[model samples]
Structure formats: structure tokens, C-alpha cells
Target: MDAGTELEDHFRRVYAGNVEAILAYAVRRVEQPEDAADVVAEVFLVAWRRSRELPPDDEVRLWLYGVARRVLANHHRGGVRRERLGERLRQRLTAVTGGDPAGEVPERLAVRAALARLPQPDREVLMLTAWEGLQPREVAEVLGVSSAVVRTRLSRARARLRELAGDELTEPGHVLDVMTVPAPEEGR
Candidate 1:
């Protein structure tokens, strides 16, 4: 067999042997099953990338467990970072709007309700562009689709949102306008 075939066979054997144990290890550690799945995928990705350096079958499972441990640690750190960022955003919004950021504004509530009523794909596409501030091309990468498809979904989603939230949805910025908090007047 060629060197590439040998490497593939070795990687396959290692994967088959340890995938279940790694998944179980992650499932027990992570709060959500989806997070556990992500951990397992990251572990296997590291294994694939370092296939040549992997030890014999007897030791590969232990190696994977080590990789999973680090991956879990990184996942935890990421969660903490996102939480901190959200808190900072809330604080900034409160400072600028001069209102309780935790309280839902009627416009925001209406927009959220309308978004929730949308199909998951449409809602995701819209939020990714408007809320996450990603362009259609970037959203396409996140959703694993062509940019053209993302643009089409965004257009349709906006139209549906307008139908659901008549008069509230406006021109120039659509979802972004509804979602943006107006700054307090200087005198106030």
C-alpha cells in the first residue's frame, strides 16, 4: 500500500477505536450534548492532524483523552469570554440609552417575536447579518452555503419580517434599525 493509504488506515483504526470513549468522556464533562459533540470533533481533528505522531493503538486512546481535556478547557474559556462580552455590551447599551438594558423595549420585543415566528433558516440568516454584524459572505461561511444563497435568504427573511412587523420595519437599515438603541439626548 502507498504511504497515504497506510496513514489513512492508521487514522481510521485509531478513530474507530477511540471515538466512542472520547464522546462519552466529553458528554459527561460538557453541560450540553451539542458541546460534547463539538469537543469530540475537535479531539478527532487534532488526531487527524497529528496522525503520524500518534502512538501505537494501545496508547492512542489515552492520547485522545488528553486532547479532549484540552479541547474542553478551551471550550470553557470561550464560554466565559462570550459571557463577559455580553455583559459589557449590556453595560454599554445602558450607558448610552440611559435606560435599564435588561428591560426589553417594545420595538425590540416586537422584532424578537417576529424573528421567532420565522423559519429557523430564515431567522438564523437574518440574525447572522443584522445582529452578529456578519456580511452575507461571512454568514455563508458560518452556515456552509454559497453567498448567493445567504443573500437570497436574507432578502426573503426581511420581507417576511416586514409582513409580520408592519410599520415597525423601516427603510435604510431594516432589522438593524429596529434593533439599534437610540442614544440619550445631551441635555437629558
Candidate 2:
């Protein structure tokens, strides 16, 4: 197949299979859903640009994650730009709507705190599953490890979060709901 065709196919398969998980991973890192979408878009764009170098399907998902990590790092290094832009946007939106900028839900704040306390690998596993919605195997791919390792990490992460949250963390969807709140306009 031509390069364009091959790239399109790659995107079709990878995105269809893994976009939600990728977006979730981005959300955990960036703390803004819109920014997360941008990250995911950039990741796919990189995949398209380097399609010739992409590995087989089984590895493509993880490869995309590695790309996401790099994109996030670049974003961090350019932090002041995004912060200034966000501040300006927030000011404009508040003036237009006569409302405070949206804040994180309390539960989300707790979850964030708990997640922050987790070790890096544990946090990644939790985000990969809870936020990114990756299957254990897919998370393994993202982490470049075996599924068994992913499961172990996830179990440990979950335990740690539970310990941090105490009883409140036990409910289904509680953590996710806390982490994901409605956008300001969406609340209208």
C-alpha cells in the first residue's frame, strides 16, 4: 500500500482501538480535558508522520503512549506559555459568563492527592486503567512490560489509593467521577 493508505489504516486501527485510553492518560497528566484531546491529537499526528517506523499492531498502542509521554514533556517545558494562555482564556470566560472559573470537585481533589502520593509506576498503572481505560494487556504494552506486571502494578496502585482515600474510595465510579467533572458550559 501507498504511505498515505498505510498511515490511514494505522490510524483507523489504533485510534478505534485505543483513543479513549490515550485520552484518559492525557487527562491524568494535563488536568484539562481539552488539553488532553490536543495531546492525543498530537500523538496520532506523530504516528502518522512516522508511520514507516511504527511497529506491528500489538506494539502500536504502546508506541503511541511513548509519543504521548514525549508530547507531555514538551508541554511541561513550555509551561509558561500554556499557563498564560489559560489564564487569559479564563479571564475572558469569567468576564463573559459572570462566573468563577471551574474548580475541581472535592472528590477529584482527594483523588488527585491520593494519586500524587503514589509512586510513579503505581500512578501510571492506575491512570492507564482508570483514566485511560486500558485493559491490563494494553497497559502492559504502554508500559513495555508483561501483562502480569501490569496487573501487579494496578493491584498495588488500587490498594494505595484505597489506603489514601480510606472508606470513600471504595465506591464504584467514585474516583472517576471525582476526576472528571462537567465543563462549565456543560453545566448550563
What TM-scores do the predictions have? 0.55, 0.42
lDDT by residue for model 1 (36-143), tens: 999999999999999899988998898898999999999999999999989877776677767565554776788888889999999999888876778899999999
Highest TM-score against the true fold, candidate: 1
Summarize candidate 2's per-residue lDDT along 7-121 as a digit string, tens digits.
7886788778888888989999995678888898999888877877888989888988899999999877788787887987776667554654345356667889989999999
**Which residue window of length 10 is worst by lDDT in model 1?**
179-188
Error of 2 at 6 (Å): 3.6
Clashes of each: 0, 1
**What lDDT does each candidate get?**
0.85, 0.80
Estimate the TM-score for candidate 2. Answer: 0.42
Can you give the lDDT of residue 187 in candidate 1?
40
C-alpha lDDT (0 to 100) for residue 162 of candidate 1: 78
